[model samples]
Each structure stands twice: as structure tokens, then as C-alpha cells.
Target: MEPEWIQAMQEELQQFKLNNVWELVKRPDPRKHNIIGTKWIYCNKQDEHGQVVRNKARLVAQGYTQVERIDFDETFAPVARIEAIRILPDIMHSVCMCARFQAAPKESHHLVVKRILRYLAYTPTLGLWYPKGSEFDLVGFSNANYAGDKVDRKSRSGTCHFLGRSLVCWSSKKQNCVSLSTAESE
Candidate 1:
């Protein structure tokens, strides 16, 4: 490999080691099954203030070429609510006040590192920035359609809340049960 390429690979490996993302397990070679291929991805790392301070590298699997029910099973993942996240600090404080204070548990940090690595690898140029001269206003919109659920004939409601023209929160959820009328839903 070229010197520059070697350097980049080393950096990526180092980051992987730090993250404890995954271990490369090796076994006896098979005749001809299926193996997913991966590629290097790079991106710029920004600080909490939305300023680029470093470059990140990652190794990402080419999931698109993978066949369903073969290489992977499910790609579904549940998302946390933004409102819940915004209340986390207060919840933590309440919990602390209720009992003797203790340090927060740390388990998902490594997984988060792994996720960051994958994200950086896949979107090397992607970044977030708070531009100057931006308006300050809070706006939101929600919509729902009945009989959209194929399983139980339930409606699906979607809401998106924005802050100063920036998308900050959104959600989509199926109703608990089929609503006979829209007014009954409210």
C-alpha cells in the first residue's frame, strides 16, 4: 500500500481499537458461500459547538449488495423520543434527589463509538453547522391518516417540530387501535 494509504489504514485501525466496535473473527475458509465486503469511509469530526476539529475514518459494510434473509435478518431499530431526551437531565436530577447520588452507568459508550466510526466511515464529508444570521422561531406540524396500517387497520400519525427553520424533532407512530372516528382519537 502507498504510504498515505497505510497511514490512513493505521489511523482507522487505531480508532477501531479505541472504540472496541467489533472483533475480526477468522475461521477456516469455505468453498463458496457469501461474504460481505467493506470499504473505508472518512469524515470531518466537529465539536459540540459545531466546529470541525478533526477527521474521522471508519470501515463500513456494503449492506446494499447483501441479500435479505441471508447475510442479515432485520434492519429495524426503535428510536428514542426527543422530548424524553430533553427531560433526561431533569429526570436524572429527580432520581438523584430521591436517593444517594451515584455516578452514571457506562455501557453504551463503546457501542456509541462503534456507531460513530461507522457513521464517519460512511459520511466523511457530512457535518453539522449552526450558521450565522439565522432566524429564531419554533414551529411544528403533525398529520395522520386513518386505515393506513395493514396489520390492524390503525392510523399512522407523524409530527415534525422545528426550531428556527431547523429540523429538531419528528416522530411517526401507529395508533393503539383502529379509530372509528378522527374526533375519538383526540
Candidate 2:
């Protein structure tokens, strides 16, 4: 293996150990339970000019093999959709999830992930900008797309909260209930 890749893996293992992420225990009885597997995911971290800056290695649990109630119950993590201006973080998250489902991801997914990386390279300094002494008023804007998802025909809603001139929070998510009309979708 490449030295950087080895170093990245070592760093990941070190972090896990430092954080006390898991414990070594005897294998569970096959008749009573299942043991979830894990794997290492590797990637190259790039700089603004698209040059490789570092190597990244992540250890992820095989979530697919996990039984819903037996291995784990629920997730508290929040989900968000990609936006035009704030694209990298959300798309990166989506791509990571897609990668987990497939043993080998498709070419299209790779292209999408690469495109997001390129975009990030082009806009390395892009981020929320709040001028000093700006007003502190809180404001929010929200919108919805009616039956946006073609497969399921479900509506999507998004909202952004701003404190004065800076964005404080934002989210875009699919609606749980079917909307009869545009008004209802909003």
C-alpha cells in the first residue's frame, strides 16, 4: 500500500483508540445474535487547486447487515438536501450514503462525487460571511416543491434561518404526507 494510505489508516485507528470507540469482546452466539462487520473506506483529500493534500481513511460499520431492531433501533441524525450555493457538504453527505449501499458504486455516483470535489476546489474560500456589527434580527425563509420526486410524487420543503446578515440554520427535506395541492405543499 502507498505510504500515505497506510498513514491515513493508522491515523484512523489511533483516533478510534483515543476516543474509546469500541471494545474487543468474544463473538456473539450464532444462534442468538448476529455480528455486524466493518470495513475501511479510503479517499484522497484535495486542496483548492485540485492537488492531493492528504489521504483519508474511514472505518464504517456494515449497516446493511444490521437487523433493524436487534442491532440498532433508531437514528437521531438529521438529513439535508443539496443547494446551489451550499452544495459541497450536502452532496458529499449524499454520496457517502450512496457508497454505503453499494458494494461497488456506479460510474454516475463517482462522477457526481468527483464533480462536487472539483467544485469545492474552485471555491475553497466560499462560506457564510457576516460583517462585524451587523444587525442581530432573526429571520427565516421557506419554500416547497409540489410533487417534486417523480418516483414517489412526494413534495419537498426547505427553509433557511438567518441572524442579521448571516445564515444560522438551513434544511431541505422531503415531506412525509402527500400534498393535494401546491398550497398544501407549502
Candidate 3:
């Protein structure tokens, strides 16, 4: 890489506050634990208007290298469904409801935040793009294919609300009731 390009990339990484995308990790003690292998990834950052703004670097661990207890005790994480996200705003519509709600539990919140940080580390340059000259109209679409979930044999549907060609909101979920026929499901 050119010296100027490297310097520019370093500056951009610093601006994003992502200074630790790569670092050498001393090999873990053989008796003490398992250590995950890591890999480096690179990409270009794009602005909301779809212009390439900067080159990005990321370091990601090979999660499969982890061993139980030695590397990690638990690897499970919870993620909210789109319906849950959609309902949250509706549920909190009342001012009193917002006031009565308690903050998220700290430990869980910390774990969630840590996972997000790790994700950012692995995909530093990933972002949305809304280029100029696009249409600006409101449009929506909803669709589903029955028995989408192999575990439950349930039908699932999703809806996408768009502002012109830019997608603003979308959701996917299992239907509340089972339908005997495809027409009924539709």
C-alpha cells in the first residue's frame, strides 16, 4: 500500500474510534484455555448517499476455534424479532409507560454491547447508502410463504415500508394462526 493511503486509512480508523482492529494476542496457556484464531478483513466505507469515503480494516476471531469452558462458558445471545421492534414504539406510546419502564439489566446490556462491538470490529466499513436522484415516494409490500419455519411448520410474513427507493422499515414474523390452505394463508 502507498504511504499516503496507509496514513489516510489510519486517520479514518482513528476518526471512527476503532484503533484496535488488529493486535497480536499472546498464545494462551495450554493448560489454562482455548484461544480463538483471528483473521483480518478490509473494505471501503460508503456514506449514506453511497459514496466511498474511506478504507476500513477489521479483525475477526475464528469462533470455531473456541473450546467449551476453556475458551467460553456460554456463547448464546438473544436478539429481538422485528415484530418486537415494531411493537416497542407502539407499546411505549404512552408517556406514563415510558416513565414506568426500568432500564435494561446492566450485565445483559454489557454483553449485548460487547457483541455489537465485536460485530463492528468484523465489519467496520458496512453501512447504508441513499444516493442522490432517487425517487421520494412512500410504498409498502407484505408477503409470506407458509411453513417457513422447519421446527414449527409455521407460516411467516414480512412487510417493508419504503420512502421512494430507500427502505425505512421492515418486519418478518410467524403468523398467529395456521391456515389449512395456501389461499387461506394469503
Candidate 4:
């Protein structure tokens, strides 16, 4: 490899080491374990004038080759949906439930309302907590309780957005239209 590329790779490895990104493991049997493959990517980071300022190197997994069930149950990607500004509730599922019954609250709804009030009374200072030096990465999650509402037969969808480890935004709402299948609800 060229000296510049080698230097970039070295820098990348140094950063990983400092961060304690992974640990060395003994080689597993080929028959029992599906070892993940990795690749090295190199690029030149540029300034506003399009002048190369620094060499960048990245070590990445070749995830595409892995099978579904045998390799993993679920895979996560760091992505944010620009269109969904207000999304899932890490909290306030009860509050959302109360809102649904504004027009006609039942005895059960009244009990839930009282319970919510009691919670508020006990934990007056409770609120969204954010720590110092939190990461800037945006993470979002969404799931639905299919046909959960007995009255309307509508699925309740909830979503939560986070900036690093801190909760940023969330929402819990009943679907506008009824969906027949679980996949359709999602």
C-alpha cells in the first residue's frame, strides 16, 4: 500500500483501539460459525475549495453476504426519516389513550385518568433527561399494537426518536385507517 493510505489505515485502527470498539476472539469452527467478512474503504476528505485535506479510511463489514435466520434475527441501520418529524413514544402511551376518549370517556378511561394524575403528583420533577456530551447520531424506532383498540379496531402506532442515548421526540397515535395485516400496520 501507498504510505498515505497506510497512514490513514493506521489512524483508523488507532481510533478503534482508543474507543475499545471490539475485542480479539479465537477463531471459531467454520462449520458452526458464519464469520463476517470485512472490507477497507479509502477516500480523500476535501475542503470547501475541493482540495484534499485528509485521507480517510474505513473498515466495514460485508453484511450483504450473510443469511437472514442463521446469521441474524434483526439488523439495525442508522437512519432518520425526514418526513416523520414527530414520532414514537418512549413515554406517554397512557396520555395518548386518554386523548382517544375525549369525546366519550368510559369508567375505565376515568380510572386511567386518575392513575395518570397520581403518577404526575408523585413524580413532579420527572421529565426528559439529557446528559452532557451525548452523541449527535439520530436513531428512530417504530412498532404497532395490531388491532389493539377494541372500539375502533384500529392499530395504535408508536415511534421514538433519539439523539445518541437521550430521548428527543416521540408520538403515539391510532392509525387513521384500519389495516388487515400486521405487516400492513407496520
The prediction achieving the highest lDDT against the true structure is 4
Candidate 4: pairs in clash = 87-171, 88-159, 88-160, 88-171
Give stretches of model 1 more than 4 Å off: 1-131, 179-186
Q: Model 3: what TM-score?
A: 0.27
lDDT of 2 by residue, 4-70 (tens): 9999888878877776767989998988997778988888878899999988887777865544432
Decide which is better by lDDT, 1 or 4.
4
C-alpha lDDT of all candidate models, in order: 0.58, 0.69, 0.56, 0.71
Model 1 Cα displacement at 3 (Å)? 28
Candidate 3: residue 183 Cα off by (Å): 21
* Candidate 3 lDDT by residue in tens digits, 25-141: 678896799766766456666789999786665444577654443222443333211112122222112222333234744665555555555655765576446678878788989
- For model 3, the superposed segments whose C-alpha errors exceed 4 Å read 1-133, 176-186
Q: Is candidate 1 or 2 superior in TM-score? A: 2
C-alpha TM-scores of all predictions: 0.29, 0.35, 0.27, 0.37
TM-score-based ranking: 4, 2, 1, 3
* Residue-pair clash count for candidate 3: 0
Q: Please list all clashing residue pairs in model 2, or write none if there are none.
A: none
After superposing candidate 4, which stretches have Cα over 4 Å from the reference?
64-186
